[model samples]
Target: MVNPYGPDTRGTFSFGIRLGLLFEVQAACLSAICVVGLLVYLGWTAIRTRRQRGKHALPSHLHVLFVSLLFSDLLHSIGSILNIPWIRDSGVLEGPLCTAQGIFRQMGDTGVALEILAIAVFTWGVIVRGWSSPSLKTTFVIVGLIWIFVILITLVSYGVHKAAGQVYYGNTRYWCWIRSPYSLPDGIALQYGWFWLTAAINLVLYISVAVTLLKSKRRCRNAQMPEGQRSLQKIAFQMTWYPIIYLITITPMSITRLWIFTNPEHPPPFAATALAAVLLTLSGVFNAVLFSITRPTLIPQKGHDHDPTVGGLRSIYTLEFCQRPDEDQRSSKIPPSPETPCHGEGTSKGGGTDETYV
Candidate 1:
């Protein structure tokens, strides 16, 4: 029996279907493992950080970014996991499942964009201020504002299309995503506008982060302490990977989109689409792994020299800074403790001696 919705053997669609299925299966397996690992790592770190909250200064901003990245990657992985079975059976974009898949895909897409933006901002903050980056209040406010803005833009674009009696429906697909073959001017404009907006934002943030890291490294080179050089080097390496991965994942899509726009008569090379999907999928996994490896603090393990005690102490001051004036005053009202000598310091009784402040 002939399959109407199946891949066309004469064209690249057949090859694309095969390739996408292969990649999706591999991605699903890898992503499933990664998701489990991430969840375990996140749980372990959260518990450890919480226990040592008083003794160690936590990198709260970095933690926020880490959480966001994990969440986004998890969502992306979920989308892939769902799509893999569909693709394997050649049932993608069919029935109600297509709409469900589209919703998940959109969710993953938005999550990924927000994750990248959050990481960029977090990295930039670190490069600029190091230990004195913006307070949690400021970071939260900024993230909230960015999310709200993106949501508004998506709604407006969606509404405009629907109002024009251009509500797109598909026989091959169930989701209401912007239909492909965007030959119409309005369709092309919307598609390109989103593409460029995301890419531009990513480029600007990454460039800023790279520049800042470079400048910091140069400054550290002239400093007396060699430890500064090591710290700066680590940061430099981590910051560099982000832009590299971003370009690797997005460049193919950018080129393909441009080519299709310029040469409307020809369809985009199927290889490009396949490459883009694979690279983007891998990017999510890579980001999660890179962060965990680079920032050892994010992964809690025994025998690691990185102390959470100092991080906890730092968190206190940072938290204080983020609180309201009245709350700050209330916190400040706590009396300072008198100096005390340890039990083993002097006395045979093994008791400490307390001395009052002058």
Candidate 2:
């Protein structure tokens, strides 16, 4: 007698089986918690920023990009939170449910890519131009263009296959994926194409932003900045660190995709999936952490000493002033020395001088 759910056919008892399973469960739980927290934080921040701006407006173009990123992340987190339990109970490599899971996963992937692109572009623009109010019209146009391009590409490739035949429903985990019936070459190509293209774009954007930030930091160090302005610069540098976190968490998954594309015959079973899940979970958690730390004013402060308006205004003024070479040069000029006080009865040349403030 043979059991239907036995290990022999199902490919259980594999390397790192127990550990992988435990990690997957833990990652799912952690991701869910992070998603909940992120949603609350972002929602509150958006509302607060809107109210402060009056007429429900974003504080700046960069702020708009940040909001878009948070919104996309929230969507991805929600999808993952739902999909994880279903994957656990039903198994990702089996049954009709896999198709649904694949679709959701693909959507989440798209959201992540869009968010990263937005962050990279926005940060680059801010660092390069010192834009205080990024044109909303321009931002919306860029977002529209990206969405349209992605949709067109997806439709032209995967849409045709799914429409022409029953490409989705199968034991295959290729629901949101494009695959061939007889040969694996086409499927492999499509998979690698998507992963590599996204990776290349992300690498370029992040590297550019990182380089610009380093240059900015160097320039700032050479210039004399006020305490408040220096604090703002530090916050901006800290924000730049999120891209490194993005690269670390997403690079492994990209490499795994490349491996699978090159050698599809013997794809690692639970290990690869579990690893990808862990990376994605970490990405979501880190993003939430970054948002919290970099934008503390977005959080509701009860009896807090920090004034969000003054801080924001000072940051804006500093950024604007720093952009002007003439202003910077003029600011560096030395002030006239204070006039010497006349000596009194007990005053000597060194000891009797009046205390003077610049």
Candidate 3:
């Protein structure tokens, strides 16, 4: 009589398997907890302040983007949390349930790409093209477009999964994403394929913003322009590090997975796979830190509708860095610091550095 759950554990050590599985579970669980807390707080604040902004108000930069991003993170973290039990126990989940998990995982992965791409595009618009704040309706429209994009792509993948059958979670990947996550008949076309394209678009936009900012900064210094009127690129740079950080953190997983795809005969070291799992799982945590979800809102009275009397700068190019003595009575956060390059950026998530790996 053959055992139905067939115990063919060749080339897989029991202790090593247990340890690796435990680590993956812990990373995903912990990351989920930390990131979800941030998401909750952000969502609550957005809801509470909705009416306070007055009617027909347009909030400062990318209000919809932050909220949409938190939703995606929530989906990501929750999917991981639910999968812990499934991954640890021996058995298959209900068909529709597994299908739901696959969709949620795709939502998070694809959703992130759209979010970062939106931010990068936003940065380019403000810096290069002199675009200003988008109205509330316009912002919601953008949010709708992103969500729709993710859903359509996810359905495409789900269609493929139903046709293929076996392997929904934890075949090649440790977490609860589509199995053989970065490979294919279907994986590349659905999952990992988006990785490189998103990364490339982000890099180009970041470079453009960085160069434009530096040039503007130097010109301001030479001409002795009023300090208050300098471009806010340095500070803006802080908020723009997400795409860069995302790329840096995901590179390890990408490289290792590619190697496995190319050299299937010789399995890569368990350690390599473990490192990748660790980084990928901690992604939401990094996003929370980068966005400063725990800190005070950077733009005050932001939720209230736009007041024409508000003296905020017209575009990022003309944004003021130094506060004038007259405006000191106001509750502005940006401070004066002429000598240091990246100084005055509060340790808030807006600082142009990433703590994701750390």
Give the top-scoring candidate (TM-score): 3
Candidate 2 lowest-lDDT run of ten? 340-349
Residue-level lDDT for 32 in candidate 2: 52
With a 3 Å backbone cut-off (N, CA, C), the pairs that clash in candidate 1 are: 55-309, 56-308, 56-309, 56-310, 56-311, 56-312, 57-310, 57-311, 57-312, 58-311
CA lDDT scores, all candidates in order: 0.49, 0.49, 0.57
Candidate 1 lDDT for residue 338? 21
**Residue 110, model 2, lDDT:** 63
Candidates, ranked, TM-score:
3, 2, 1
Each prediction's TM-score versus the true structure? 0.67, 0.68, 0.71
Predicted candidate 1 versus true structure: per-residue lDDT over 1-358, tens digit per residue? 2222332222223545666657855775585577568767767756665565434334455556556656656655665566554545544443344434444444555655665666665555554334454455666676667556545544565467558855332222311234443233533453444445656776776677666545544543433333322543454456557666766766775676567557645747666655665666675677767766655455445785354322321221121111122333334344322221111111112122311000
Say which candidate scores most in lDDT: 3
- RMSD, one per candidate, in order: 11.3, 11.9, 8.7
Per-residue lDDT of model 2, residues 156-255, tens digit only:
5545656885444223331123332412454334333444555566567657656655655555454445555555556666656666776676677666
Residue 211 shift from truth in candidate 3, angstroms:
0.9
